[model samples]
Target: MKRSLRRALWAGAVVAVTVAAVPVTTAFGAGTVTTTFTKAQDWGTGHETRVTVTNGSSATVTTWRIEFDLPSGTTISSAWDADVTSSGNHYVAVKKSWAGGLAPGASFSWGYNGSGAYKAPLNCTINGAACGGGTTPPTTTPPTTTPPTTTPPTTPPPTTPPPTTPPPNTGGKKVVGYFAEWGVYARNYHVKNIQTSGSAAKLTHILYAFGNTTGGRCSIGDSYADYEKAYTAADSVDGVADTWDQPLRGSFNQLRKLKQLNPHLKVIWSFGGWTWSGGFTQAAQNPAAFAESCYNLVEDPRWSDVFDGIDVDWEYPNACGLSCDTSGPNAFKNVISALRSKFGSNALVTAAITADGSNGGKIDATDYAGAIGNLNWLMPMTYDYFGAFNAQGPTAPHSPLTSYTGIPQQGFNSDAAIQKLKSKGVPASKLLLGIGFYGRGWTGVTQAAPGGSATGAAPGTYEAGIEDYKVLKNTCPATGTIAGTAYAKCGSNWWSYDTPSTINGKMTYANNQGLGGAFFWELSGDTSNGELIGAIKGGLG
Candidate 1:
């Protein structure tokens, strides 16, 4: 699940129109510019907008600015592609240094989130000249009908028929789990636990939770924990002693030994998690260079044997996560294409993507289906759809397989995401369902069922409002079930999470949906006896 601090921005249907171009001759320069305002999405109180500035002049544009006025009550929340500032009802957007100097006939766009009803901006101007040739007529009609009930087709139909049979479920079905690099710290979860807990025997692959994206290249998140720290035989995977002069002695070496015990296990180094995702924006600028850097780092001679492939866990592409990204829709496809080109066809390349199934949501923000050809599989982060992020009342299940009445947001469940992706031409066999090993809850709740009021985040060992299943199982025993998940109310606190039984149901849904497999967030959350992992393996079988 996503742990970044960002407000839940619901997706809505997009309505795009090409406003007529207007020629503006100014003392600064003479150019023909057109401003296209696209109502990208609107979820009642909040909406998203995309504005494109086109240069029709013969000369190149070095610097540009746009000015507009919002409706009486509307206000901008967040923006991308340009530096935006507002005063009273006026908003000014200036091109970012990176986006400056547009060649003739070129175009650049920026998007933003706004409050209140959607309204066309007034007095639109580009380079101090009238926009779209004239002022945009005021829009009184409400933003296009509520977000569409279904996701409109984004990709064209394939020229050839899709395979009639599902991809071979090699070795039954894939059971993937993440191994966090930082877990060896206060969490004390070492690679050796995967073996002692019996998870290795049942797992198909292990995703080493993160390599970093820094300076537009693949870098180490924690050098000491990743490969420098020494582990004794007691804590090592192969009961091997680490010599003082050894070049590699940390988790990377331990993973290498784990593969010896479980040959079927494949390890993939994932990059750009919530904390490290900011660099992806820079990477998208030059995907080939980024891919080359990743190839070199993953196959770094020292521990090349440890990693089977690369997994890009970009919190999101062409959308907002920890930081806003304005790389446009093809950014993700371009990056994956470069990775596939550099890594070659034999290496396993995958990605963990957003599960925002809402109309015009993150799913529409990128060309995911177009990139699937280069990927071994795509994991939709179906959990973390809802959490204590909205600290107020109206609590709901965080990872629901299906939607139910009074759901906090529409199209936020796992099923909705899966259906949307399939509709967008992503083969069911290439998609993996995501499961969370922890639970989200609230404190001071009076009612037992969801939608109850809460004082604030529930107390947790590491962070407020979140607790691992290992602790949640005993701390807050299951009291009932809702939306294909488990919930419990112990004292004034109310918690909602998934259990073995719920995972069984989710796995059954995955089979029915013809999904490739199921993958969970991390390994440390399960009990020492591998209770949850057992359920996953048993259910997949």
Candidate 2:
């Protein structure tokens, strides 16, 4: 589990909604166009707002421009889905080139993050008509002629950019990304980033990682992160501050709001990852008891609506992972069978299995094919095949698509795993190729090639030997491609990981093989603008 380095579970950290505004409209020569502004979220310091355009006329509207005025203290910092530029407190927004024209009854939306508290825009107009379609409603006007009797603070709270969503489409393949529960702490990544970075728009489903499997039963990984930490209005998904009296707050509440924003997206609670897989041994002892506990927890009224299904990420079933499992090959199949019996047909039941495809390896240690009838999909962890785990020697790519000459291991690559599983009766469509969003590195390397020797693991921001693609994309870009993976020889530090180009190649292979879509270990690895995920979505198409 190359991504398992992130299993550093620590305590959780603590971390908001706005009013809906009415829309106005105007009629152009081609058709009638309408624009509406909504205050999506409001923290004391910053806020997020959205603008929606709709075509209400009989004919197709080719284009539109929106202009609006903000109060002296409010300003637009950043926006997405549309091109927006501002001068002083006045702003102009034009449709993006890719958005094209709107047909009859069509609606389009874009948004921005702003400075200061939430304040509705004024003098808003679409084309030449008042937004929403009628006369502008009257409102209290600021006294411009005379300065305010009581001057407010000269400096406003620091402004932050808000979420900007594009039109959602996945080209029919499932794009799943993991959102670590502990990320809110040191990583400072929240549910809102998923929407703002545009990953939310590209993703078909989100795996809320590692709900604890301690005691052979499902449990909360972090109380604060799971459903207790209060989010200020500014940090919230919908811009509504969390209340003490509310039934749920933390990421679960934020995920609820995220679902509202992106109705096409589904969230799954994933139990047991690398650090927690030991519990599966006990869980396998009585699969029925374990399945019942998971069902009760996933369906709890407190956040029953937050999840669409369950995903089991047992590191290795009936085999060795972080710790060894001697529960027998039938253990995995039995557990999945019980889960399907409990979760029923509507709920999605999925699993992430080992990628050790070497003959007589972990792939053969469990009855994976026997559990397929109960699973919606199976994710073969394709990365982590080779890394700095063996501190000294033979630098190799962590994720290789094919077996290359002088490869350190046979049947350790992605193609080998996929082929091995297929040979065992698993359907190509039921298997999802796993991509790692990070890279593994080693220091004290003599040669840049795969056969070089190394002294130790390279230093990283969070852990040794592992770093996010976001940092590696700049710090140590790819210098060579071998075994269908990218490697960088920056100084004595040699690192190997997948790039967008490499990911595109893998996606092409996925399509050619008539396999299911691709999934990554996590989300925060991508660029802030979602460059890597964009490549995955584009490649899948």
Candidate 3:
């Protein structure tokens, strides 16, 4: 996702409140606190809850605690953003160390997952004072009770099937590249560039991104650029011009020609992205329907031969991305399982997921390991861990392969995420290490090393704080290395990006770790001569 879009969504608050007899308020020393309980997501057997505490008084609140009671048979399974403890039916929540202080009018929220029926908490209290709210009314009992009876079954139960194991690595490494659909507009990067740059011969798969996930169904992102636009004979790969009306004439036809030139290449249509992932929540509601829509669109008779399979790019499922999702941990597994069932074992199925490896981070928010069996591979987005998003000093590398002494954040590096996923039961062979062909840096830096202070984001040709390696490599050549990555400080302007030398080191790490292979964000970032792509092919070999 773009940093600007992420900031816009984060600024917009998503709050839901339940009305009570009186507004919940509690008096403390020199201040007052009001807490609101909202249900984020609710299914039959499980649900998610969010509690927001606001400082309503003039004084700042340095610390806080909330206590409440749950209905009978309800139990908390997991929680985040706060420390929670339960005893019998009573639960107590304390603010996390990082979220301890709140200025007046500011609010902090924490969420949890629970089992059994959803119910608003009773006897809510903040600090030691009562929150002026009445308890929920008790359920009414039936006048008469009947004994339960059981009937014997005439047939025996069916046996359970054994779990399926993922296929072995077999020593074949993959080199996957993503081709953006909209790149043909302003970027003017045609499919022929792959052949011209020598990337066509090295690539094993080309993921055409991205098909849209709209209205809870798979849809074409850009019809004109995908298969409608006409190409001149000089621009066409096969040197054939399209008539005024042709069934397929756009990038689809060009990619088919490219595949013929490189017989080992496979093309997969990737659906959903950071901006389009909002529809995955609705898709999870009916996985079978979503799968059917995807199959039809990917295998459309118009250009069915263009795509070999499908790739789902639901960013940070059941967690925060461009939007927040409370679809529960198993939502990703259910969706992928449905796709596998619909597409069958022979068809390729894969996904691009979050690389957050911190405690209770995004990796812990979804069951990626459980869904690995249904996937051909999983791409952990190891880049974009940090960027101009912070917008201040403490400049750090956005895609470090390993950690350094003064790394800005913990568990944000690629190695941390890869190891975490492997520890969680995902086979190393099914996980592909992600590499970014771009660089993220800041300007106005005094120090050249990794923890330098910066004034703001560095300007780029298109967007600030980000630029393709093809542009950055010559503009600001790397001067030093840290934590197994490259950095450059050219006249007070600091930049951090992966160089050919650093890419070789990362590839060696992947091989030693028994990883399947490597994949980059997009092919357009490489130089016209395919310098970066050549390095990747050479290193992987």
RMSD of each: 15.6, 19.2, 19.5
Candidate 1's C-alpha runs over 4 A off are 1-171
Could you tally the backbone clashes for each prediction?
Answer: 0, 15, 0
Q: What is the lDDT of residue 441 in candidate 1?
A: 83
What is the TM-score of each predicted model, taking all chains together? 0.71, 0.70, 0.70
lDDT of 1 by residue, 184-203 (tens): 99889999999999999888
Clashing residue pairs, backbone N/CA/C < 3 A, model 3: none
- Write candidate 3's Cα lDDT for 1-541 as tens digits: 3322222110011111211112122212123565655554444465555556656666788888888888787887666546789899999998754343777666555556577656777777778666544432112211121101110011000010001212221135677889988878877888988888888887878999888888779998889989998988877777788788787888998998898887778898998888888889999999999999999998889878888889998876888877888999999999998898787645678888888877778888999877765677788887887777677768787788877788877887888888777566564556688888888888889888878888888888778888889999999999889867888888867788888889898888776555667888789989988877677777777
Candidate 3 residue 436 C-alpha distance from true site, Å: 0.4
Give the better candidate number (2 or 3) by lDDT: 2
The TM-score obtained by model 2 is 0.70
Question: How far does residue 478 in candidate 1 sit from its true spot (Å)?
Answer: 1.0
By lDDT: ranked, best first:
2, 1, 3
**Best candidate according to TM-score:** 1
TM-score-wise, the better of 1 and 3 is 1
Q: Total backbone clashes of model 2?
A: 15
- What's the true lDDT of residue 337 in model 1? 84
